[model samples]
Structure formats: structure tokens, C-alpha cells
Target: MTTPFSSLEDYIALPRVESLALSPDGRKAVLTVATLSTDRTSFDRALWEIEADGEGVPRRLTRSAKGESGAAFTGSGDVLFVSGRADASAAEAPDAPQLWLLPSRGGEARCLTRLAGGVSSIAATALDGETVVISADLLPSSRSIEEDAAARKRRTDASITAVFHESYPVRYWDHDLGPGVPHLLALETPGGDELPEVRDSVETGRSADESRGVYPSHLTSPRDLTPTPRRSADTAGQALTPDGRTLIASLRVAEKRSGRFVLVAIDVASGERTSLFDEPGVHVESPVISRDGRRLAFLRAPFHTADAPADQEIWVADIDGGDARRIATDWDRWPSSLVFDRDGTNIIATADHDGRGPIFRLPLDGSAPEQLTTDDFAYTHVAVDASSGDLVALRSSWTRPPHPVRVRADGEVFLLATPAGAPAPLGSITEVATTADDGARVRGWLLLPDGASAETPAPLLLWIHGGPLNSWNAWSWRWNPQLALAKGYAVLLPDPALSTGYGLDFIARGWNAWGAAPYTDLLAITDEAVRRDDIDEDRTAAMGGSFGGYMANWVAGHTDRFRAIVSHASLWALDQFIGTTDNSEFWQTVFTPRGLTENSPHHFVRDIVTPLLVVHGDRDYRVPVGESLRLWSELAEHHADDDGTTPHRFLLFPDENHWVLKPQHAVVWYETVFAFLDQHVHDRAWSRPAQLG
Candidate 1:
């Protein structure tokens, strides 16, 4: 049933919908209709609307917002979005991202905001359509559009060589040289006089110097939005006032420790701010509000984020900022994803306190919370239509791939992702059990290739996600599991030790242990996959990005299980990475009892034996490109030893950063990766490194 192709470019693309949102009336579904770039490895997000019944070829609403996301329809049907609203370069000045207004029926998008500095997120209210609250790169107090992030880091005496990527994610990256210090500077009066600390607006100051070494690469040398020690972090989406008069979200402000966070409510009309929730020495994440707008929910942990709260409990607050409280009196595991019902009678969120993801609901009037869906795997996402209160969620297991289903409160089910006779229904998803090297039962998902059996073992790809702190849920999306599976290779995302929701001890166990037991979980999963009749162990390949990229690099150095490997925005050199990453202090010291400078990939590059493919973004300040070159150079030097070491190739994208957002570059990168796999895994051939246009 698969398309037989001579090269990766001819492969059939994976069909999927992402970021699904419902129209106010619940008659239409608005989602991003995404397809693999013709280049065969990248993806593009276009606005698409489909019937609520999950029928028809979705109507494309807008094609112009290339990198835009988080789309929604106002109560009146006008389209709203958060996108590349401005040139990040203009961030220091008072400009806005290009906020556009698109007609619900269809047409060219109209600009709403000049959108100068980066506008990261936006949302409309259920009560009134025209009102919106957004989060953006506040104007930095500085002015210097000519220096690179590296230069800025250099100017600040930060280690420039190991910083990953060029520009760190605006909110994700903080100015940090070490504990008790911030690498970014606020526009201050230098000298005996202290500059008044301005916390309400983004801060920036102009400097013509191009030598502020090791700043973010994605951002051109320009002004930066100095984080208010109180409003430094933000939420994925905003919740509106019952009357659409305000928007509530979580923001990260500066802290004396490694990471600090604050959740606030902003009046849409007056721009007045209400500090709803604040925790010093703790991190706040994913703040969401209920339908009545009287209650708010979010996740909180330690500032440096090494440990969870005494419990990562779900907390709620009065919209007026009078009385705030905790919803779950006892939370054993971390909580994820929050959503409120149409009438504000119930609050829904995903958590793994039960060992696996089980959707649960808490009553607003103080009723006990109840688990909604019971599954063996994890639920990565949740969707609720406020108009009708219809709910949909995705749950995946180790052996089974992710399946999206419309679920009812009474336990009824209707499959959503499956179309009648759609190539391969998600039904075949399966799981297997493996024991980590330490003998703990670890679960894994298995998706076999089409038209495959024991006699036809297919190539396998060990795909790992970043955020050793993040969990890989069983869900379907365009970027992973789906993309690789469509390309004829089996993909694996094992929930390793450092992974969240397994309880604090399990999560903290992997700390500083770096290349130790956490690796055992991944390898154990691979060992089980190889034991399957349909897997081609000899033709295996491994790939990952960010912290996962660190694992990929570490795996290659520790063993040669795969034929080829790709490391994206990787932290390859521990020492350099600790000193260079935008989160140097956190990753270096806070992430573990020991520091990352002592726990990096550079320590074992000399022992690497696999044929490697190194990929990085010049703008990635999170996991800098230098890590790639360090490993690549070591491989090159090994070959020059007359030792005839295995060959290595490097792929660098100049204008991109941590995540590949550009259409053409994504295609090229995807194609290269698949071609690399085809040579060593499926096609069973090798060739000189050829650049793809």
C-alpha cells in the first residue's frame, strides 16, 4: 500500500490536523491543515476549517500566515491568530507584530497591529469577539541591531562557544551566567547610581557594538525585552473575561534564583494588570481559566525547576484577585493541559498521578474530581468546545500509535482521526513491555510498516524528543511519529527516567546520572523493538533534538547500535554546553545536583563509532551549533589519524533557529534525514554527503 520510491522526495506525505479549535456554535472545526514540505521533510501550517461532523475536504481559510499558529474564531466568526507579527529585530523599538483580521468566510488578511517586536501568543473572549489579549517581546530597553547574540554573551562575559542554536526562545532563554546572576542587562545608569528597576514594560537600550559575543543567533543584534522579575513567563493561550473585558495568563518574571514565574490578569480595556498568582523560587507554567472567568489554573514548580512543588498541585484563583487556592489537595504526579466546560461546571486537565495519563474533571463548586478516561498510555492533549461542551482527546500506548477520539462523559467513544478506509486506521497501535537495565518495567509503542511481516523486517528509527523534563504522550501530530511512520520507518518515543509525571523521585533519579540509567530505558525499548519479527535491527538509525539531541550524541559515543544519526540543536559538549547554553545556570547547576559543564557529550566524543549526521540552526541559542562542529571536528580528526575512522557530515541552516519554521528549509532538512536513513536503513546504501537545494 506504500508508494515505492527511488528517493525520499517521492514518499507519500502524512495527512494530519494540528491545533484544533472549535467555532463558537460548534458547527465547524478550525485547525491547521498541514502537509510535509514537497522537499519531503518539512511542514507548513495553513488555516483550514472542517465540518464539526469530521466530514469533507477542509476549506483553506488563509494561506498568508506562513509561520502563524494558535488560530481561533471570534463569537462573530472572524479569524484571529498569533504569528510572525513583526521582525524580531525591531523588538527594542515600540512596534507591534502584524496582528491581522481575516474574515470568517474567506479573503486576504487585514492587519490589526503593526506587530513590531515578536508577538508570541493571542486569544479572543467568548463573551465579546473583538477583544483580545496577547503576549509579546516587550520593547527591550536597549538599541543595537548589529551585534549577534554571541557578541552580547561575549559582552556579558558568558561562555560563547557552547551556547546552542543562535537565538534562544524569547521566554525560554534568560540572561544567566550562573547562580544569582542574569546574563541580559537592563538599560540602567552605569555607576554609583542604580537605574530604577522598570518591571512593567519590556526593556531595551541601543549599542552599536557587534562584539557582545554569544547572544541569541536567531535574533539580529538589537534591543531585547528585559523581563520584569515578575512577568517573565507566559502561557500557551489566554483566557478571557466573562464579558471579554480582560485576558488572564501566566508570565515569567526575573527571580534571584535560576527561574521565577508569575501569573497575572490583564485588563484588555485599560491595560491595567492584576497580579493573581506569584511564587518566589518556583516556576509557573500553562495558566488556564474557567468559562465564568472567576477561576484560574496553572502548574508551579521550583524556580530552578530541578524539583517539583511539595506537590505539583492544580491551583485556582478568584478573577478579581481576592481569594486564591489549590484545587487538588493531594497531587502525587504533575498535572498537564487545562480546559473548562461550557457552563464552568467542570474543569478538565491531564495528569499521570495514576502512573499513566487519565483525564480527570474537578467541579468548580467544590465537588470531588473524577477521572474521565482510563487508558494504559498517556493522553498528550485535550479539546473541549465551550459552545456545546463536547470533548475530544488523544491517548497512545507503547505499542499502539496515537488515536484521536471524541469521548463522552458517560464513556462513549467515536473515532475522529480515522476516515472510512483511510490508508491505515489507528487501530493497529500496540505496546510491549521491557525492563530497563535496572529491571523496572518500562513500556514502549510499536507501529509496524505497511505490508510487513517477520520475513520482511523494516528499518527502524529511534526518535527521541527534547525536555528530558517533558513527557512524550501518545498523540498524533504532523511533525513526529506520523511523519516518520509515513516515510516507512517505525518510530519510538520512550518515556525515560528523567521524564516527568513518574513522581519526583523517579524524575530526579536521572539527574546528573546523564549517560547512565536514563539511557538504559531508551536502549531497553530498542532491545524489545529489535526482538519483534518486523524490525530491522542491523539497519537502525537514531535521531533527536535539544536535550534529546544530547542523548543522541551521547548514545553514539557510548555504542554503535544504529547506522546513521542526526542531532538537532544538540548539547554535545557538556562542559561547553553548561557554560554556553542560554540556560547555563539552570542546565549547568540547577537541573542536577551536579552541573551540566561536568555532564556533557564532549567527554566521550573520542569514543564515538557511528556514522553521524549533525544538523543545527545558527540562530539556536538553546543548544548552539558549535556542539555539532565539536563532534564533527573530532570525527574528522579521528579520520585524519590515519585511523580511517567512520565518516561524519554536518548540515547547518543559517537563517533558522531551535525549531525549523520556514517551509523550504523544513523540506530540505526532512529530505536529508530520510535520505540518510534510506542509505543506511531502508535502501541499505551509502553515498557522499550531497547538499539539497
Candidate 2:
């Protein structure tokens, strides 16, 4: 007999494949697989290679205690990756990730560059593998690599641990910014024993206490490509031209009220820059240069506001920023992961549609977009082999984790890698649709557990997705529906108003009115789902995180339909959340005082009748821990008169961030959730999770 899949232990231990990169010749492909570390406190990533033909078994490429990731192929077929491994010839900064190169034919990997702040991302040209560009952190006062190292040593010796900020945002979603700013560097590999020239773009301004050091001779000299002091470019989405002559990047431009992003093109040889595209109040990002170096494609969206909702549109322009046109202007969905087809006549991209993320083919000739894939699976990191028209992507679904797959011209998909273990049997997933009170069409995914039928119906669990802007189109390890299915519950995944894949009007329906259209649309879809014979409507629960958590809190106040509610890192008082969130300026532009007062869940806390389970992480900067604390305190005050029958609970993780990442914490999260449901929904005695004791 086959072993059954375990929810917390087995699911958290599964090897997750995140991204895929195809070789220039299209013969080899590299996949970045992240697995649980030995301590199970974090994930370790490594590069794995497989044949694009789907014949040979997958083989591990690089291994180290620190692990390797960000794999890319050079024009000469060599594999270049990033790691933090310590080497005797290099400076001993084990925390800093550096570049490493592995020979295409086969050889031991060698370290390339050693920077003080470490490398964040890299891009290489297909014309020559040796020509490369990297994004690294550098102190604003340091001009060269040696100066940066000296400044770092001085700071460490003084034991100073404070960051000074002059901007609106000091911290992002999880971590603090500053101490060093992001800078782009251009370098070429040394040929034969000849050392390349390294130029320091700015003068070194170190204090008298700073140490001095010499640059390594094995690496080529790097030139500072981004010379601006306070303006940092997004290197993760940066793209390089085929000839390696130009670099395209999205730069963050600071403004008085809110910031805007603009696309800029840099000359690799002359160190000159030109603004390719810049709109007054809009943000542009995700630039992809065509293989021929003739055209550039990017996504543009307005800055968040009540008047302009965040709906992204794809735009095409000449390499010199001329003849720009917005393609698929009439299309409803916003496209992502944009890439040029083998021919420059079309673009291949992924977008949220219905309840899934499917790839779409958009023609440059001004025609409507055509959906390529029909299944419920979501695709990401799409890559097309220029030599052949073959396409490859990382596909994932509600039941399946992300895996590398090949898409044929006829829309057939073939799995490229077979994971080691199998998950427990999953229920059947079907698409359900309904009309809201305003006659708007909404859709959702209904997961029916195994052996569920009309005679023995399964309890319903409404799982709301975060993003408020993001739809439930992809598989998420942190909030997998399989755990709920294994507990004999039917899961309902709904995409209400403000969810992408639908048009801008759908998003506008909930703009600054979060508690209005989105709530009713969710309710309408859940109403349709519970009507199914296999779902038990009388016994139901609701749960969500982030924006979904906000909705769960709203559900508790608005209706007593659910027996229990689980809200994770949710927004309690909108006024307080908008002022304290990491990106408060961005939210300030989107919400008004009236909207905050009208939509806040904390205002209606006195109406809550169902039991609630609040979960939060102290490290979550996006949705701070104070939101949950205030919620718990208010709920406690309201329930002081009642007996001990309600059984409301709170779960807190000190080390975690917005999401529960550690393996042990994830197990506890699920256990506590199910236990709370069993007590209120099933009318059973409250049993605390054994691990909590």
C-alpha cells in the first residue's frame, strides 16, 4: 500500500522548484530547487541541470554548505551562478553572495568577483559569455571595491549598528534598507593571464580611521554603471541587449508625495545614460529587450489612487525610445513575465484569467490576445529558445508544486522533472461561477475532498487570497489547500473584485471601498459553492492572510455564517495601518480619510459573533504585529462578559515574517487552525495543539 501524505511534516519538506533558465543553444536547462535545510529553519537553494529533450534524468550541478542560485548561461555555454562560499583567495565575507562560473564542458566551479556588499543579480550577453553585468551594494562614500571594503571594516571595528534615512521608506516588506546602496557594475572576464582595467567612477572619500586594501588581480576591473547617489535601479528585472552594448533598467525616481519608476537605457562602453520612457505620474517596470535589439517591451501601471487603480498595461517601443505603442489596449488582464517569441512579431506572456494563470500569445500587429493554455495550472519564468521555437516554464497548480515543463506548439505540456515523493491523494477541483448583486460575473475554484458525496457532504472552508490585488491562480506552499482537503473539508478559492485577470473596471469596483464590492463578490461565489451537493453549507469556516485577513475580519463582523474565522497579519484599523505600514506613503495616496473610517474592520468589532483565531509574525513589516495585538485586545474586552464558551485564540511567531516560513511553525499553524474549527464548527470540545504545550 502507498504511504499517505502528511500535511505539516511531509508538505513542508518537499523540494520546491522556483525558476528555469534555458541554454543559448537550447540543449540544456537549469532549474533552481529550494529544499529544507538540515535544521529546518530555512531553505537552501542549488542549481540542477536537465536535458531539454526530456530524455535524460536531472543531475545536480553545484553543491556547497551555503548553496548556489541565480543560474544563467553565457554565450560560450558556460554556466554562471551566485553563491556565498568562502575561498582562501577571496575576502572572507561568508554572508555576501558572490559570482561563480562553471565550465559548460565540465569542470570545478571557480569564484569570479569579491565585493564588500555582495552581488544581488546578474545579466550576461549571448554574443560573448565573458561580457557580464552585476548589481551589488556599495557605500555612498566609497568609489571603488577597495574603498568599499575599507569602509566596511571601519564600521565593523567601531561596532555601529544604526541606519540613517532621508526618504519615505526605510524598510521594505521584510528587511531594512540602507548602510549601502545598490549599484550596477560592468566587467569582462580576463583572457589568458592578462588583467583587465578596473576604473573607479567616483573619488574615494574615506575617514582617517578607515583601513586600506588592494584589489584582487584574478578578477576584472568593474566600472560603476549607475552613478546616481540616491536613485537605485531594480536589478532583478534588469535586461541586457543581445550584443551586450546596452543595459535597460527600471529606476526608482523620488517625488514629494509618492515615488515613480522610469525605464532608462545605459551605454555599456561610454558609461552614458538616456531616459527611454518616463511618464509624469505612472510607474514602468519589467523591461525585456528583444533578441534583435530593435524593440523593447515593458509593463506600465498608474500610481495607486482612488481615481487610478493599479492596472498594468504592456507597451512596446524602439530601442532609442521612439515609436511607442500600447499593445492589447482592449485586453482585460494584465500581462507578466513578458518575452519575445522566436519571431519578433509576437509576445508570449502570462496573466491571471478566470481562476488560473495561463500563458497568452499577443501579436504586435494590434490583434486580440489568444489564450494558449487551458488548464488550471499557473506558469512562471517562461523562457523561449531562440534557435528553436520550443517554450519552457515552471508550472504549478492547487495539487502540484512548481515543476519544470515544456510547452509544444500544439499546446501540449510535458513534465521535465519527476519529484521524489508523492503528495496524498487530492480532491477534484472544478470551476464555479456566479453573479454578484450588481450583475457582475465572478468565478472561483471548488475543491471537493476524496469520497465526498451528497450522502456524506464535506464542510466548506472559504480561503481568501492576499494581495487584494492578487488572484488565487497559483499554488502556494504556505497556504496549500491540500492541508484543508486532507482534514475532510471542501475548499473554495475565490477571486472577487480588485483581483487581477479581470479588467480594470473590476478592480475599480473595490478601489478605496474594500469592504463593498470585494466582500459581496466573495459572498456570492461562496454562496454558489456551498450550493453544491458535495459541500455542507451549514458547517462552514473562513480564513485569510494579509488583505484576505482583512476580509476575514470583515466577514466576522458582517455575518455569522461561518462558525470560526482565521485572520493572519490582517488590517484592523485602516487609519492606523495606513500610517504604520512599511509603504505608508503609497497607501496614503490610495486611501482617503473617509474610506479608512468606512472600511476599517476594527470599527465594527462589536458586531462579531463567531469565534476567531488570530495569527501574526513580529517581523512582518508590510502588516505590522500591532494590528493583530489591537484586534485581540478589542475582542477580549468585548468577550469579558461572556462565559468561556467562545474559545478565541491567538498564535504568534517571533522569528517569522509576513508568512510562516519555518517548517515547525507551519505545522503548528495548521494544527491550531483545525483545532479551532473542530470546536466551533463541529461542536467538539476544544483541544489545544500538542506542539503548543
Candidate 3:
């Protein structure tokens, strides 16, 4: 039997559980699972229900061709989700994702809102179930939902796609920021019968648009909660008080070439806004309201500078913005998420710790945080059962994909029944460590194939993680190492300087000096791994994407130890990347003129002797395609022969962004990567994939 890890088709077809949402009553939990679509070109997400106690068989809740996501429970136990599924009775299909409700009593899901720009995300659902807050895009010229819809309709009819931006960043990651500004809207319950009717004849199905409402049954008119918002409302982290009276949100305050997020409170009924915390050079995010509606807990992080990195400090304050204090002052790890406990006495947080993301319990009394889980797995989407005080989350490690799990207050974890069973093991994983020249500790996770020893050694693939600020502590669908292990390669995921989970001092070691400490750390760790008997040092390769991709380019020019190098969405020229990337402001501060001259990989193209593979997505905005274009041009100018033939190959994804996300594209990505490595590292004949043609 061919395992999922061995066959890319089977791997893409495997069901993936991405998120978990627990009911407040603690009776059931809902999971969002993505499966391969019928065409095999996309993944369709649907909702599944499983018992919170880990006893009942998993049951499918909602299915649609367009898919559903962002599942959250209303106060009345209704499942609120966002979907782009079209309505059969409607005259036209929905152009964007709309809010839908799957009743607690079990019935077909129904559309609730039909704004032209559609819903961005569900901010919060009031505990009383009478009001729900959501974020939606509104044209700056429009004041109400109807006006915004009309404005969008006119733009569509005229085929106008221009956006007038008064902001620093007009684009992010892969897409343009907006012709519309994001605003928080509240939907008050009376079943939508009393709302004013819309007057767009072309929009409503009825002949007399003046006398007809825009939507059919279950239509709820939205009241603007944050009006006159620029670009600040889109990325706000919001939480609603249990009584549905106040909304706590982190709104971005635009600055010169940069921005800072400040926590704010809004009166849901009166639409009044008040600032909670607005300190300079700091960001407040991840607001969580206590169950009793008396307090708020959020993460405060100072902006990073060229000289040093910053830490995320967990802070708590009263609902009225009084009695503020920082908790777990002694904790060194940076928390990625936080949620208040059932009784609001402690905060259940998750942070990266020594190559694993574990749940921690931080008490309100300013005491030390308690480590809850000791396993080598990472947890996400953690939710507390207010009725039972138990916690449920989605957990996974390098050896496994994400699956729903029930965690007790005492840190006991139980695997819940899921439709997606575990795939065959790819290989075994261990640890590798070494000391850098500066006497700093560097470590990484190593995946080794089975039956590898001194007699039959496996080729080592040194995999560098992106983020330069991120850690390889969790499972990644995009940068999975399991596939490499299944192909008889030992994969090494190293966390050099600037990786999180380690103390701030560790990250500072590479501050504005990417090529110095971070570079040496990779070499030191690779040396330690290659020294082992089970690894073949002579057949080693290096590969990375994003920052990792940048490092791969650096390694190719800096050393000849690796047989091959694969750089994906990498930064080739620091001077060019610093100005062209999505956020030029932050990069400008980090890259001094001297640093750019010393660290740029393009400056050392003549030193590269090993075969190289360069992969990039045209839509990538973080590290623009220009970097690779310049690198390719430089490679050809310096190394290409008379026939213009070179060992280096460039794989470009026209439709992909920073990552190749489409199902078909992802398969091709892996196929091309495997072929390149085989040709160079394994000394196999160069065989091009037919799909590339």
C-alpha cells in the first residue's frame, strides 16, 4: 500500500482539520475540516461536530461547494460561520463570503447578511445571543451598508478598479489593501423584518425595489459600529463583553511609513468609541473579555528596532481601563495566543518552547506561569468550556497533521474522534544541537528515515525556516519535512539566531546582522548533524523558502558543502528587497547601509559553484519576484555558457502568492522540488515534470 507520504496525490487527498470551536455549554465541539474538491483542484471546507468529552462519533454538520470557515457559537448555541455558498433562490450568486447560521436545533444553514463587499470575519458573538459583531468592508464614501452596496455596484458596472490610498501600505502579502475600508458592524436580533427596505432595482429580485428588502428570509440589517475608519479597522482584534454591551478591539493608528495598534472600547448600542491603551512604540493585540465581563487580557509588544528585538508582555486590566498590570513578568517565551479561563482567574495561553508549542496557565495574581503540556506537539485554536472548565484545541506535530483534541484543566490530553484518520508514519524525528562561534546555543529538529545507520546512511537536507523571527515548532502544510523524509532524505530544521521561543537576547544576536550570527549558526548545526554516522555528509543539500530561501541563496554563495540549493520566494539582494517589499518602512530600519553591502547574496553570485533551483510566485509581495528575476539575470550573466545553458533552474508560479496554495500547484511544487534534489543530490538523470510544460 502506498502511504500518503509516498504519493503526492494521496497526500493532497488526505482530509485536513484546520480549526476547532467549542460550545459554551460544553456539550459539543465543531471542527472545520478541508477535503479535496471533486475537481481535485481545490480544498472545500465544511463544519463537523464532535462530542466535547471525546466519546461520540464525529458528525458532519454543513457542506457546500463554496465552503465555510470562521465557525463560532452564538449565545443561543447557533453555529455562526462565513461562506460564499450561493443561494439557489437568489437571482445572482454571492461575490464574496456572507454570514450564515447553522441552527443549534439542527437544520439547513441560512444566509443572514448580503453586503456587497461581504463579511470579512466574525468579531464576536454576544453571550446573550441577541447581538453579533462582524467586520465588513465599506467604501469610505458610503456611510451605511445600503450606500456601500450601491457604491460597489456602480464600480462593478463601470469596471473601475482604482483605489485611492492615503496610507503607507497599499498592498499586503498578495492582494491590494482596498477601495473599501473595513468597519465593525453589529447585527441586532428582531429577525430582520423591521429594517428599512433597500432601493436598488437591479439588486433585489422584486420588480419594485423601493418596496422590497435586499435579501429574502433571515436578512439582518447591520448597524455600523466603527464609522469613518481609514485602514485601521481591518486588522482589529476584537472581543465582545458577555452582556453584548461593549466591544473591545485593537485598532491600528497609522503612523509615518508604519503603524501602531491601540486597544479601544466601543459601545455597541450607542456606537461610542473610547481609547483603552494608546502607548507610543507599542502594540496591543489579542483582546479577550472575561466571562463575567469585568476585565480584559491582551498581549502588549514593543516595536522591534535595528538594535534589538521585543517581547510580548501579557497584560490584564479592568473593563473600564483601570487597574492595569502585567502578568507572568518572569516568563521569557512569547505567547502567540491567549484566552481567559472559565472563571476568569487565569489565562490559558500557548507559546513556542524549545521546539514545541505548549499551553500555559498564567494566574491573575502575578505568579509564575505553569506549563500545562509536556508533549512534543503544538496547540492552536484553544477554547475553554465555560460549563465544565475543560479546554479543547487542535494539536499536531511534525509527524502528524492537525486533529482535534480535548485537554483537561490538569493538562491531560485526549484525542477526539475525527473523520480524518492518521496517515502512515513518514519517519522518526529527533533533535540536533551545536554551539555557535559566539558561544550561543543553536538547535534544530531532525527527521530521519527508517532503517538508516552506518551501513546505509541517508542524505541530509538542511531546511531553514522563514520569519528569521519564527520557529520550526509546529506542523506546516506548506513547508512540510515529512515528504522529504519519505523520499529517503534526513531533514534538518534549524532555529538559529532571530528565532522566537528563545529569549529576546537570542534574536538580538542576529539583529541587523543576518549574515553573521544566523549564517554561522546554520553551519555549526549542519556540522553537528553531518558528524553523525547515520547521515551522509557528501550528499547533503540545502533548501528554504522566504527567509529560509534567502539563507539558501546565502549558503550557495558562501559554501560548497551542499550538492544542491533550493531557494523559494527568497530575498536575493538586500538593497533591492528593502525598498520593494510590502513593508519597506520596517526593512529600512533593520538594514543599515553597511549591513546591506555585507549581507546581500547577489553580491556573491560569482562564488556559487553548486547547482541551484530558484522558485518564486509572481504574486508574492513580501519578497517580490524582482529579487529572483535579478538573481536569475545575474546568474546567467556570470555563469551561463555560450548556449545560454546553466545548471540553475527557475520555477515560477504565476497565480501563486508568497506560498503556492492551490492544490494542483502545491503538488507540482513538491514534484519539481523532488526532481531537482534527485537530479543533483542523488545523481539521477534530470527529468522535468510533464505538468510544467
lDDT, model 2: 0.81
Candidate topping lDDT = 3
Evaluated at residue 385, the lDDT of candidate 3 is 85
lDDT of 3 by residue, 373-450 (tens): 999999999998887888889999998889888888889999999988888667788998998888888999999998
| Lowest lDDT 10-residue stretch of candidate 1 | 183-192
**Model 3 regions more than 4 Å off:** 92-94, 189-204, 207-218
Compose the digit string of candidate 2's lDDT tens values, residues 1-693.
122334567667888887788887777889888888899877788899988878788899988888988888777778888898775443243358898778886767877777877888775444444677888888778878788887887888899767777666777787777778878888765322323333332334322212235656546668788864564654436677887778887878878634788898889888798998789878888888777889989988877776658667899999888999999888888876899887777889998877788988889999998888898899998888777787888888887778788887667888786433336548788899998888788988888888899999999999999998889988888888888888788899999998987788888889999999999998889889888888899999999999999999999999998999999999998888887888887777788778878999998989998889999999999999999999999998887456644457899999888998788898898889889998888898989999899
* TM-score versus the correct structure, for each prediction: 0.74, 0.94, 0.96
Cα-based lDDT at residue 578, candidate 3:
79
Q: Give the Å shift of residue 249 in candidate 1.
A: 3.3
Tell me, what's the RMSD of every candidate? 10.3, 3.9, 2.3
Which of the numbered candidates is closest to the native, going by highest TM-score?
3
- Sort all candidates by lDDT, best to worst: 3, 2, 1
The Cα RMSD in angstroms, rounded to one decimal, for candidate 2 relative to the true structure is 3.9
lDDT of 1 by residue, 509-537 (tens): 57667677777788888898888878778
* Backbone clash count, each prediction separately: 72, 1, 0
